[model samples]
Target chain A: MEPLTVPGMLPALEEIGRYVMAAAAEAGLDKRASYRLRLAVDEIATNIVVYGYQPSGTEGDIIVSSTIDDHVLKIALEDTGPEFDPRQHAMPDEDELTRPLEDRQMGGLGVYLAFEGVDDFHYERVDGRNRNIFVVNRPSAAPAT
Target chain B: MDVNIRSIDDITVVAIEGALDAATAPIAQQQLLPLATAGCRILLDLTGVPYMSSAGLRMLLSTYRQLSGKDGRIVLVGVAEEIQDTMSVTGFINFFTLRATPEEGIAALKG
Candidate 1:
């Protein structure tokens, strides 16, 4: 069990994304799955940077945990800044793409895309922390194209 | 991020060279918004853009929506194949215009 604690800022997002990607690949996750994992991790990290904590101080942080068994990559993100439930938000409308720009809305598209990209996603606020856990991977024995 | 600005057929052309992911995305949004409001035909040459993320999508889509509201134009030029695949996966292929190059994007914006 390895863990990383970030102060919950936008710049740190890519750092954590890279870390997750490297760990996922080392654990034998597929290439496509790894990119999807990056996207999911970015979404969650951005959420923490934006809504997880107040701007005045640095008491809040995001903690990421990883566990690899065989080829499975299970990742968890827990933040103690604020109580946020991304799962409760509705998915963005993909059809909004072709709509004239005037018809499109400005926010929430990433969360929906993140939700659609991952396999198993869960969100929970447990004992004063917002915990998000998701799994991404493919079998190590899967043939490489 | 590398930006190359040029002019062709009376349109201001900007070529972005890099991955428009979580890190470099705000730059894309910030730079493109000014071009959008300038109200001339604008072409974003993404031929050099190898990849784009949700942050980048939000910028593009949000700018597209804002420009369309003002009856302005934004054209897509040189979107890479890999980006097209990501766009399709996220259903953005159906949302924004996909162009082969800057000239074609300018033509499409005019139409």
Candidate 2:
């Protein structure tokens, strides 16, 4: 089922995370698996708050959900804030992942991190909204970096 | 949102207990900034903190930058596994000296 809004940590992200994570956990999702999905949710939701609000002239909300019937936890974040297809960004190069701690140059790693955390990721811009859907299957429960 | 205060040698310690995300991060950042600037050494005890978002990460990064310039440091103590994992995956585990316990923050200051 869907939890509360996970938008921008705007007084609701953690609450959203708790609810979704609880659902995932109750569905037999492990702590590592649950944390990975929720963290990815937080990261993507924050991205919507930051980028979705700019360059798009629209604003939207973050939606998180877990489904036992589907044997999957699908986190779909929708924001009318901007037309961002996370598919555009390349995965971060692990060899170059380590950078100066304060270097803002590597700020784009959030999406890469989220991508790594999930089983499958897709980004779509439909009907004037940017939708990012990340799917995690139960069997492949490893929390990849 | 609750804050507990403790003194460990030369550093003033503040243990933040609660959510450090977009909503609460600003509050925590504001509360820590003035004290971190006015003091010589500071330690943020994150023992009871369940979660911290990138907004919180930004505040910590900003604080580290500020403290580093003044010959002061922000030591993190009792970081949870999830927090530690997040920091490491983001390549931030070694950015600052991390202690396993709050008392170690004082010890780091002493050394």
Candidate 3:
């Protein structure tokens, strides 16, 4: 699918989701896989906009591009914001996840869910750009369109 | 996201009719949090929501926290399968009462 470049802001999240969903549909992903892919991308993109760009007091654009191979669909989100690696962030442990509602902390839940929702998540810094990649395997029985 | 709020015999039924993600979560929070006052009973109808990211989960947790000690209660109805999986992954699913329909949700909240 063609890369989608949108401003790194909150309002652009919906557009990002739309781009991911379209890519998923093209890949013939099932509803569950499609939703998970969208959720994973949305979570990381949200983090990029809210924590990466908003905190730095700078504005940039998020470039979302997708590629579908025979066995997998990979989506990459590239942004020029500060060097923020989602893998470096600590995910909530079992104890933290099982905490009572009143005591539950909201900090890392999104990042954790984003990584957990996808089949594979990778983070890298290439030439000063943060590239977070999410992959979901296409079902073997899914017929090619 | 469109949040519709109504009362069914002291149970505030809020039906959300759109994707609940980062962009729309704040809007949902603005409309749903205020209804978490003391002794409030809420029935959240999520039938119209086809997708929900972690931002939606955070908003739901925030609402649950607000109603924790205030004797308020909340029940979720018509949660989609995908959203339920996400909620289960985050452990947020254990905090709320889940019902299959609005009638069941209202009954659960009332009981």
Q: Which candidate is the best by DockQ?
A: 3
> Tens digit of lDDT per residue, candidate 1, span A21-83?
777776677666777777787787777777666453546778888877654577888988767
CAPRI-style grade of the A/B interface in model 3:
high
Decreasing DockQ order of the candidates: 3, 2, 1
- For candidate 2, list the clashing residue pairs, or say none: A52-A81
Candidate RMSDs in Å, in order, are: 3.6, 4.0, 1.3
DockQ of each: 0.42, 0.52, 0.82
TM per candidate comes to 0.80, 0.83, 0.96
Give the candidate number with the greatest lDDT.
3
| B1-111: candidate 2 lDDT, tens digit per residue | 667777756788989998776667788888788776644788889998987766677778778767766766678898888888878887777687899997777788777
In order of TM-score, best first, we have 3, 2, 1
Better of 1 and 2 by DockQ: 2
Which candidate tops TM-score?
A: 3
lDDT, residue A43, model 2: 72
What lDDT is obtained when candidate 3 is compared to the true structure? 0.90
Supply the TM-score for candidate 3.
Answer: 0.96
Tens digit of lDDT per residue, candidate 1, span B1-111?
677777777777888987677668888778777777646677888888765678887777767766775767777778866467667765667656768866578778778
